[model samples]
Target: MKTLTAGRLLPVLGTLLAALLCALGPGAGSASAHAALTSTDPASGSVVPAAPRQVKLTFSEGVLLSADSVRVLDPQGRRVDESKPAHADGKSNTAVVGLAGGIADGTYTVAWQAVSADSHPVAGAFTFSIGAPSKTVAEVTTAEAGPVVDALYTTGRYAAYAGYLLLVGGCVFAGVCRSSRPVQRIAVGGWITLFAATSALLLLRGPYAGGKGLGSAFDLTLLGDVLATKPGAALLSRLLLLSAAAVFLAVLFGSYAREDGDRTRMERRDVAYGLAIGGTVVAVGLAATWAMAEHASAGLQSWLAMPVDVLHLLGVAVWLGGLAALLAALWSGEPVRRAEVQRFSRLAFASVCVLVATGLYQSWRQVGSWGALTGTEYGRWLLLKVALVAGMVVLASFSRRWTGRLTDGRPAPKKQAPAVRAVQAATGAAKAARPSRKDKDASPERAAQLARQREALEKAAGRRQRDADEGRSGLRRAVLAEAGVAVVLLAVTTLLTGTQPGRAETEQRQSAASGGARTTAPAASGPAETRIPYDTGGTNGRGTALIRIDPARSGNNSIDVSVTDPAGKAVDVPELEVSFTEKQKNIGPLRTALKRTSAGRWQATGFQLPMAGTWQLTLTVRTSDIDQITEIRNVKIN
Candidate 1:
């Protein structure tokens, strides 16, 4: 029983080690062409004097122009822009749209929608004033910047998938073929490979996702940002945890392997220790994969999403890793162990069931539509992956059937006796030619006994040879089929990682709608009404200021603003500047000043409130724009 368990466990342990090593190695998909917005013209919050001739946007990669839309809206929420967006001349990253007349003085918003190169829809808005220059608003909003993060996140995610597949396959093979030393060696090599691969992946992940070149990848700032992001934190945490787990397991396995004299105790310890280590390693691997794929290591959803992601990863590892073990089992010429094979098969089947269920749920969340499966590059690649997985299942089914037959322990049929006899005769001739010195006994009784023993040995050899031939043939076929399926699935998975899933059609429709509205607007007319109200409730009078600026038409213009104190006296304002806040930097200046109007009501003409926001009006009634009076206000134009 001890030997039997060892036979079942050693190969699996070796394969597990391989998976760890491979996960640490250098990864595939080094190209950093994932979709990302780089910059925008009339930046997020700029107070332009006139409606610009055109608005321009740039991205990290060449954008798909047909699936992008840009709109210019007046303070009244009316669309004001005549030109449809056109691909910028000689620039794939830039998209430009010509503006129409009637863009009045006040605040104006430029709303944009685009499909990334990977087919994900990203939309956002920026504001630029025509006349009065208010504060600078950032060109990139959180929503706009989402694509860049998503792209980076996805890249790490798919690399993780590849790593998981490789590791699991290696471990499974090692576990099942423990009887053969050569097989054990291969399994050990696999462990080394997985560890190396995973380590490389960790290194690559930092630079690849953080938008940095390899040279400065380890810089403190870059590392800081990487550490802060969902994928980076997850990778770092899981890598450390897994490495520790692997080392501990290795030590335990070595200790168990060395106690050969006490076979019974050693065998029991080996099973217990192997399971403890293997289970830990498996858990870590699952966690790491989930961390990368689901960004499960970050934020409020981390508790729930992380565990679900871990389970999904675990299911994948068990199924793929178990397949690797089955492959190793088939590689050994020894008769397949029926009970062990059955146990692994059952586990593999259960893992596959879990994988499918979890995978479908995840797909629904990510893909969103049936059209996405074919309409988007990501969808198509995913479909291909599904097809390949189906093929693997068919191959697995065939393997299970053959495994059942091999385990039945039935003798060769009478119809196949002739072939068996031929093999026996060949083995007999070989043995006769290589006779042992002990077989040279000359006494009659001893000679008769020797002959009987030789005959028995010959029969045993024949049976072993017949079993070897049959096992090899069936295993070879099964292995080849499995390999084919694995290759196809790997290819599909690789492509899926490279593509983005979403609708190209929807983007175009939105762009067209935005374009048609631009043609109906008139030209800008006057300074319009720009009202700046201060919220002086908080300490240091640090409350939001509500600034309402109505851009009557679409072109550029400016307005004036003034503030009166509670005493109904005109206040000399200082330290007043405007800016927009978001993930990326884009802010404009509040250049115009308030002039004395009638009595307590002072007015500043040519004041521009670019984008809608809770603008902070900093004033030092008697000093500079940085000291003294500080007031914040929330203002919505349209």
Candidate 2:
């Protein structure tokens, strides 16, 4: 966009990016999910009276779950959940799995692993029981993603973001802001990068979500599955938009270069309107893809959030991208038009305003509360982003102040060109040949030679100075520094998109806060239940033993133990015994004999818990007269 004489093309692309930013919020699952489990059907620690038909899990944002992503295991190591995997609905957050035909009454652990929208593998588990909240076999927590997958996925996103800025920035800034070939070339490069990255993301989507290596990235089934998702559709839309923008840019930029020939050519207004305005409209339309796919579409007041995000993205493109284009022109040592600098200044200021206003809203929505700001990973990244933006503004102000020198209607000083210096040398030689008033001491011929030598030396000194200084243009350097900061800011934004949202973290924190309180209350009055699984060595002896304590108090309590195999069948044993030992007090192992209530079930009339402590319970099973085995389990006797 080298049409330097007129407001050749309007700066409409800025509006597009600014709007995109405003419409898109950053976090967990393409900003909506951050991969946190939003809700569970029975709730994390809720005690359901009877087994539900299915176990339902809701993510904060949409996620990709594999076939084995969910599981329900009983105390006997028997899988009580169906094997058929369930995928989350498109643009939806929930997933469900059917419970097996019959689940014995005891604690059941539901362990799950799913891929978030950001393409990171995450896992977690929750426990619920049929009758009493049986003691859990093990409290399985959240699983972390592999580092290689994280790094590769992040690299792909970074490339995509860079491409976005380049394509939009080049088209808008080079066409309207500064109008330069350097900027156009940069934009074209951006277009190519965008295409490549989009393709990479498609391939990587499978491996990313499946938690597999790069080898599995090209899985056709996985790719098809991802394509059916909200984020997938958004990415595909971006590719289409990029293709359209490329065509528009090629025709628009090529026509101006070929037809105009010079800045004063004054391209017909109709031609400019058809090419430039239409192209910008297409670019702006493309921003909707990002807005629809990200956090803006899912969080609070999404209707308003999407529009605001669009404006924000537009502002960033115009301000940051325009600045980069301006830096290119300045580096060429071209006489930068004062008016254009002023136009950019005003635009930058407006962009900052939009960014500040929209950023505050997004932060509030995603962050939830003040405590989460310091407590959550998402909050910390947001703070860093703000700090970076603030620093960028300060640098931008400096760039604006530097541009003021150009506005003073003075050209930047430069050493004489070769032609002018040659003319000066000839003139000096003519004067030196005659006896000038200033230099009358030497002979005329000697003075002529001295003058020639002096002129050569002057030229040599200027060249040396230019070389030593590395031909640096201070005006260019200052603006370029601001552009560099913009790159860093984009990097932080990319990372932020992969992190958990503060709102979700805040909810998790609240859940944790209330968990202990629930545990202390009686099961008769509350859903506080614990189910622990234990295994003895031999096949016949290896079975789960269930224990339920009502008001599991500090005095006498009725206890029952049911032994079952992996197939969910009750197994009979010759003898069954139960005992408890407290480590803290180093107390005696109070033992008791249990009378068989059924083939594999035993019951005791009275068992005493003298105090509250973490107790180890051992169950001894006698498969035959001699072959006996025992399993130990830890129980929180609060």
TM-score of each: 0.49, 0.65
Model 2, residue 449: displacement in angstroms? Answer: 33
| Residue range 220-246, candidate 2, lDDT tens digits | 887888788766787788888777887
Once superposed on the true structure, which residue ranges of model 2 sit more than 4 Å away at CA? 1-32, 35-52, 58-66, 76-78, 83-94, 114-122, 130-145, 260-267, 407-472, 520-638
Which portions of model 1 miss their true places by more than 4 Å?
1-163, 166-190, 210-225, 248-253, 257-274, 292-305, 407-468, 503-638
What global local distance difference test value does model 1 have?
0.49
lDDT of 1 at 192: 53
What local lDDT does model 2 show for residue 140?
38
Cα-based RMSD of the predictions, in order?
23.9, 17.3
Candidate achieving the largest TM-score: 2
State the weakest 10-residue window (summed lDDT) of model 1.
550-559
